[model samples]
Every structure is written in C-alpha cells, then in structure tokens.
Target: MRFRHPDGSIVHLAYCTNVHPAEDLDGVIAQLNGCSSLVRKELDVPVLGVGLWLANTLADRLANSSDALNRLKQALARNNLEVVTLNGFPYAGFHDRVVGKKVYLPDWTESARLDYTLDLVKVLADLLPDDASYGSISTLPLAWRVPWSRTRDAAARDAFNRLENRLAQVEATTGRRIRVAIEPEPGCVLEMIPQAAHWLTPYSGRSLIGLCLDTCHLAVQFEQPVDAFAVLARAGVEVVKSQVSAALQIADPSDPAARELLAEFAEPKFLHQTREYGGPGVDDLDLVGELSGHASWRVHFHVPVHAAPRPPLTSTTDVLDESLRHLVGGAHPLTHHLESETYTWSVLPSAPKNQQELAEGIAGELAWLRGRLVGLGLEEIK
Candidate 1:
C-alpha cells in the first residue's frame, strides 16, 4: 500500500470525500473502500485517507455535547476512514468584505468570529484519529476588512494572533501538530507569492503553519507553478496540501459582444449595464446578485463542464504533471496529502453515463503524477 520512490520518499494518494452528498457518508465510505481495493489490486497502492470538508459542521451536528468529540472518533473508526483535513473556514463567521454591500453585512463580529474558528479547530484536533495528520486548515485573509497599504493593520495583526493562539492550543491538546496551511487565493488578502511570504514571515520558524498552494489560485494570479513552489520553499513554509484546478482570464464569455464591450465594461458605463441587464446573457439571478456584489466576479470565471469551453484551461492531467515535476523534483517530496479536486464534474454539461468517467479522471491524474515522479528519478514504491 506504500508508494515509495527512489529518493527515499513515499507518496500516498488520498482524495477529498466531498464527492458524495453529506447524507451519503456511509455510501461514500463504502465507495472509498472499493476504490482503495481497486487501487491496491490494480495499481498496487492504497489510498492514504479521506479528506472531509464538513468537519466543523459535522462535528457540531453529530456531536453536540462534551462527548461529541468522542462520538466523532467512534464514527470515523466505525467507518474505517480517517480525517485527512478540513478544507475551508468559509462559515467560520467571517464577513465577505471583498463583495460587501449594505445587504451583505459582516457575518460575525471580530471576537465572535475568532471564537468560532478556534472552537472548530479544537473540535477537529480532538476528533481526528490518532494516526491522522492535519491537512490544510485555511486562513482566509481576504475575508478581513483592512486597508491594503498597511500590512500590519490592527485587523490583520489580531487575525494572525488569533490563528497562532488556536494553532498552539490544538498542538497542546492533540499532542499531534496540525498543519495550518495558508492558501494564497486570488482576490483574497494574501493573493500572491510575495504577499504569502510576507504574511508567513511574522511567524518565522513556525512548523505548524505553512502554505496550501492551489495551482488554480496561482494560475489566476498569473504566477508560474515552479516559481510559486520556490517562493514557498524560500519562505520555509511547507506546502501542506494543494487543490488543483484551472483559471480563465478573459472577457466574460457570456457577453455576446464581448469584443466590443470589453472597453465599455472597463469604463464606468459597464457598471450601469451590469446593474440594468445584469451584464448581458447572465440568466441566473442569484449569480447576477453575486456579480453585482463583487466586481471581480466578471474577471475570472470557473467554467463548469457544462459551461462554454475556453483556451488555456489546464486539465486535471496537466495540473498533476506540472505539480509533480516542480514539487517532487525540487526535493520537496510528496509529504502532504493530494486531492483530485475536479468538483466541476457535477457541473459538467452532462453527467457521464456512469461513475466510471469520474473515477477514470481521478485515476488518470494519479497515474500521470506517478509517471512524472518516476521520470524525475524518484523510485516507485512497489
């Protein structure tokens, strides 16, 4: 079940368990076990663990009392699955400052938000199986309201302090270090490599906190994948886990007159057009509402499979190849878990006749990753 490479490093493939609906946790685990068996039989490797996105919510709902943590432990044990990590803190009560309006007030007061985040981290640390390692607990810096000119603004300082405090508490209680991976998301507070480095420098030499380099996020920011890997390396920030996807930077394809309207859209006149007709061809009112709240919405679009295809779209296959070349080749062996985050599968123009296509997509990506590692002179675990 171990995939060892010639370089004395082992890479174990794991995946996010959110592919299935929350109600189907049991069925999801069954499918995972089946997948693991197939990988072992066919590929001769075992899936390391299952990543859970709803750790906080599930912990809250399933385990509501002091014994809630114990209940979660028992449930995970019963299912023979371990929590690889929790993905985002979107619901940690932080406000959407980037897209804020009178209608969208701050989701939580500063103190309340910090408390909720700490509580969630604590629950995660307490509930994770003894053998499970903490994956990426994201700190969404952009969600905080602060002036860009002042990096050490009170709001940013307080947020970092809260994060450090929570990380320390988790380590103390769990006796296992939790990797708090700071994801550099485009349009977020710490969007680019330099910003991520600057943010992490404050916590110099801290092992518990590191970077979660999502290729899609970096691509949208126009950062080369290799360059990003080097930045994280120089900053001494470990690349804990990565979410791979492609980003498109172009005029809104939904706009019919996109060519001619590009200039107008860049002007204040486009704001009027956006307000009136919802920016032409945008039929979804809810999406229009999201766009109206955030101007950046029109800049980069997440093209679902069903959506119109565009150029420069990086496939799961390409992402895996480039990521492995940079990561494994640079002497940064695959220590952290890897998840095939092609969630757009559901949103594809049409669902495949069966789950085979979806499974093949993941399997192919993993196989491509293995080949890259092997080509880089890394020994494959037999």
Candidate 2:
C-alpha cells in the first residue's frame, strides 16, 4: 500500500504489527509467515506495508547478530511485506498477563530506552527498501504524569539530546533519514496536543524529532481532530505519521446501559486509559470502576475502525475521517505515512474468532482508509 497524493509525494498505508505480539526474533519471523503473509494475501496485492513492532529483546538480538538480521529481512521479502514505520512504544512484555505501567517504565528518561530506540533505528535502516529515503518510529512520551521531578526532566532532556545526535550520525553514515516521533497517550506527561507542541518547542528547528499523531488518543482527550492538527501545524511540529484508529465513545457515562457496555471491554491484558468530560476533563487508567459523568466519555481502547461495538457504545471513526480530511484534503498532503493501529483485537469482546476473520478485519480497516484517501484526490500507486 502506497498511495500518491495530489502533489505526487508517496503516502504509505500500513497496519501496525503490535496487534500480534511477538516476544523474540523467532516469533517475529513466524508472524511474517503466519499473520502478515495472510493479511497481504487477503488484500490480494503484490505488496503490503507493515508498521513492524520489534520488542526490546528482539531488537537487542538483531542489533548484535547480522546473521539473524539478514534472516529477518529475507522473511519479510518472502512474505511481500515492507517496513516503512515502526511502533517502538512498547519496551518489553507487551503480551504479558498485565502490562499496566510497565509499558512506560523505561520511558524517555532512561538510557536503556535510548539504546533500544537506537537499535531499532539501525534495524529499520537495514529493513528499509533501497529506494525508500526515510523511516519513522513512534515512541512513548517523556514519562507518566506522577513522579514528575526535576531530576527526571533533566534525564529526559539529556536522553533526547543524545538521541538527536545519534539520528544525525545514522543519516550521515547510512544515507537514510530516520525520525523518532513521541506519541502522547491519555495519562502520560505529554498527553494532549498542546503539551506535545510545548515539548517540541525547543527543538523547533529539528526535523528528526516530531509528533506521532494517533487519532484515537486525540479523540480520547476531547480535542477536535481538525483542531489537534491545527495546533501541531501552528507549532511547526511535523507529523511523522498519523495512526488511523478509533476509540470507544460513550455519550453519557452515568447511564447504566453504557456502563455495562464499557465493562465488557475492560480486561487485564492492557491498560485501558479512560477519559470523561463533565465540566472539565477526567482521566482514568482503566475502566474497572463506575464511570459516572454527564458529559461524553472516551476510552483508550482501540476499536476496529470499520466497525462499531454493540448498542449504547460507538466508536470515534468520524474523528479519524476528519483528521484524514485535514491531512490530505488540501493540494499538499500533511504526512507521508498512515498506519492503522488497532492492537486491541485480541482483547476486544467482538474480536474475530478465527485467523481468517482477523486477517479480513485488518484488511478491511486499510481498505476503508484507502477509499477515504482516494476520495480526497489521492490514488493507490500500486
């Protein structure tokens, strides 16, 4: 999936591989054979783009062994899958029993976080196509909201400076441009659009560090899709990639029926950060307790973009549509990458029961996004 914007710049559409968690390099290879290959076949296309999610352990091994790295590349080529972007947010144990705050443990403040991300850059450079000029990786924000200390802030600043230098060296040596985009979740330090913009203020002149705009996250924060884009644009923040996904929206959280509907989506595998609007805004890490509020409520759950859940619960698919419209509706496109990141399929109450249905569901989201892009004057380049 490559599409040509009206201005002729290529826009790559991909589905994030984080949906299928692979803990090691071997598991990653198996996914290419079992999952990615099937998805590409379902689309009936010669090539499919995938936002590869390589865990910390897998990245460390690949960084050390060229033999293993070459094997991974061969597998991707054999499967007709290409990697243009990566979901580097998860450090490790993404598929564990409870991935609560561990996802943000070694946030941007630790040296290990920086090392893991640099290794991913090296691996991505090796996996990128010879003709591809740039690669993108989305990472966690600075840290969680609590435990915000000056020491932590300084550590994060130092880590970012080191990362900036490393990205420069990678480009200088390999001739491939790689960028690390910081993604804002619902409860992280840089949780909203304006906060992300503020974090990037000092690095205004830098292009390698930017924002990874997730439509689901933005909607969860109660920010309008167009307004979010405008804030990023006004701040001179480059959207390295726009993740096209939707969050579960509950109109009135106080309603008993809506609460019951949301309870079905509350699981223990991943953190379901919830956001509710009453007078101001409220944030919750999970949906375990009662969400009593009169205003609209949005959860961090990544629902299928093409379909909604049962009654009394809807998805913010309209927000995704509006965001894409603002990005590609103009003569010049906003970003070159669009990745469909619905990684909650395994936990969704209505997830596909079989592998075939899962593949169709992933492909369906990509197809829906493709139609929208084409309607906005972009065409599938094939």
Best by TM-score: 2
lDDT per model vs. reference: 0.49, 0.86
Residues 1-382 of candidate 1: C-alpha lDDT, one tens digit per residue: 2345455555544555444344223443455555433433344453334555543344355434665456555555654445656654444212122222211122123454455456556656765556554545554544433334453345656765777777887678667566666667544457677788777776757767667666655555555677776776677777666654443333343444542333322321001112211332131223343343322222222222122343322222344357666765655564455554443344343444555655555455556555555687766544
lDDT of 2 by residue, 1-382 (tens): 9888878788889999998878787888988898788889988888899999998888988988999999999999999999999999998888888887888978877889999999999999888887775899999988888889888888898998899899999999989899989998888999999999988866765889998999999888888977787888788998888898999998877788988888888888887788777444444435335545767888888999888788799999888889998877888877788899999898898778977888989998888888898898898976
Q: Evaluate residue 63 in candidate 1 and report its C-alpha lDDT on the 0 to 100 scale.
A: 34
> Considering every candidate listed, which one attains the maximal lDDT?
2
User: Candidate 2's C-alpha lDDT?
Assistant: 0.86
Clashes (N, CA, C under 3 Å) per candidate: 8, 0
Q: Using Cα atoms with residue i matched to residue i, what is each candidate's TM-score against the true structure?
A: 0.66, 0.96
Candidate 2 Cα outliers beyond 4 Å, as residue runs: 278-291
Off by over 4 Å in 1: 5-12, 21-45, 61-80, 92-113, 126-135, 144-153, 248-320, 332-335, 352-360, 374-382
Model 2 / residue 320 / CA error / Å: 0.6
